[model samples]
Target: MKTAAILNKNQLSKDDITHLLMLQDEHEIELLYKKADEVRKKYCGDEVHLRGIIEFSNYCEQDCLYCGLRKSNNKLKRYRMSVDEILSSAKAIHDTGIRTIVLQSGEDIYFGSEEIRDIIKSIKTKFNTAVTLSLGERSFEDYKMWKDAGADRYLLKHETANVKLYSMYHQAQSLRDRIGHLLYLKKLGYQIGSGNLIGLPFQTIEDIAEDLLLCRELDVDMASISPFIPSPYTPYKHHQSPALTDTLKTIASARIVLKDAHIPATAALSALDEKGRERGLRVGANVVMPNFTPAPYKAYYEIYPNKYLTTEDPVKRTLRITAMIESLGRRISASQGDSLKQKVLA
Candidate 1:
């Protein structure tokens, strides 16, 4: 493929990215994945960063069409962990020697800015870990407060780049507003993670390309390219799950486009296929997020069904992921897995 020929030049236009995203031939796709894996090794090295995710709250206010936690899901049960409970979970993650703890939830307002800042402060104070927040969009003050509290990173996946599709799914706000929050978070000195969703009903390859372009434009430090796993309680419940091939292609493309960014082998892939995460690592992804949300709440925090893997003991889970990473000929890093681009700039 001529696309692969130019990938080495680091001069991809939207059309070039689109061409790579649209690679339908199995051989061509495999070649693309190979090049992406090479880029991942060359830029990020062989250390797989294990980020433990604590889904502290299932409560969300957004009514997006695809989410099981959307405000529209009346049948879903939601809960928020108290400060002590969250601290306990963070300690569990810390004990596993994981350097990053991602505090993720729906946009649950129950925990105000002070509550979140306290959580961030406690995690940093108690452990040698960096904090990443995925609590949806908040005010500039809220973002800045969390940053001041020692939050090291933030991940807000810009689900789609097409304005029309973004408006369709995100009825409450515009794509422009979402982008504004991400940019503001960047200004606050957070290692930004902005990503796109693949396999929407009417989404085209061009839309995916635009997503890659937006990530590059924002200079995101981390990115996630996961398939749209249709959820039962949402409007997209009847929609078909995206093919694993397409999602893998998108992941590889992100690795090539955002060469130094930390891309995860998303769980949605593993849920769709047993070997998804392994396949993701084979292609280009360099991070894996093990669910550390205590088991009682794990079953209920159903974003998409059959979540990748969770266990009663987070230590055991981390050990399992550790073996998996080492088996892949990659070592799980003890470092915080900070962005390579930022270090280069510094």
Candidate 2:
């Protein structure tokens, strides 16, 4: 059976993507990966853009059923870094020549609008780096405040676009509110980013396709695509995770559909497979985020189970990923000097 390529090469119907998802043979998976890699080379080339990730806080108010940092998870230890500690971490990351610092956290109420604004200001003031915030959901007022305070970008993953599935996973969170916040961020002149999980419980091909379409329609500046890994503490712990191949297919499809958006080979992808990040870059992913938080607080930054490999140091992990990209004939960029428009144009 011949399947269409969906976005660029050919017009793939929804059924083609379904057929691709149903293909389980190892050789078939390899073929898909190879095709995806070729597509990456055709579009993004081999250069990998590294963004420094600093998990500022783990205290979350929302009880998302799939996340390890949900408030109900009593087994996990929680911490929040002070402004000075965060700045110090950013300084170290900057010293490594990384040009963007992504400050991520759960929906922690402890840091209000003013506090977050100050944090963004301090990071920008102290270091010559771009600031990206991943502080979950916030009001429009808060979003405007943060953007005004020098936050160049904001990441808020929709997790899943299907409303019923979204409610099932989020328990008490509303899909409308989450999407509304994202639209609010976009309206506030921030480089907005949103994404979905690959294989959550009750996910279908139609659902994944809709997700890709939504990313296109919303015209997000960046999209993060990662496979769903079950957290042992979550209620959905027994659900099987999506195959890494399916994740790769979704990433490739995303690249084709959202051609101009900045897509990252997410660390979640790397966690599932050793060469996940490298393969992602070879298949239309141009961004790679390296954890740059202090070693003492690294373990406390968990959003999901077994995130970031335990065997290697954080800096070592970055170097290793960079080396893999270099092996693929791509360079790791030293500067985050390019604007979102500039990256899209490139």
The digit string of per-residue lDDT tens for model 1 on 1-346 reads 4865867667688988988988888888888999999989988889999999999999998998988999889888878887888899899888888999999999998889999998899899989998999999888999998999999999999999999999999898799999999999988899999998899878999999999999999999999999998999899999998889999999998898888999999878888888898999988999999888996887888888875555548788678778988999999998998888944321
| Clashes in predicted model 2 | 1
Q: Please state every model's RMSD to the true fold in angstroms.
A: 1.8, 2.5
What is the number of backbone collisions in each predicted candidate, taken in the order shown?
0, 1
Q: Where does candidate 2 stray beyond 4 Å? A: 4-16, 23-35, 311-313, 337-346
Best by TM-score: 1
Q: How many backbone clashes does candidate 1 have?
A: 0
Estimate every model's Cα lDDT from 0 to 1.
Answer: 0.89, 0.79
Candidate 1 Cα misplacement greater than 4 A, ranges: 307-312, 342-346
lDDT of 2 at 315: 71
Candidate 1 matches the true fold with a TM-score of: 0.97
Candidate 1 clashing pairs, residues 3+ apart or interchain: none
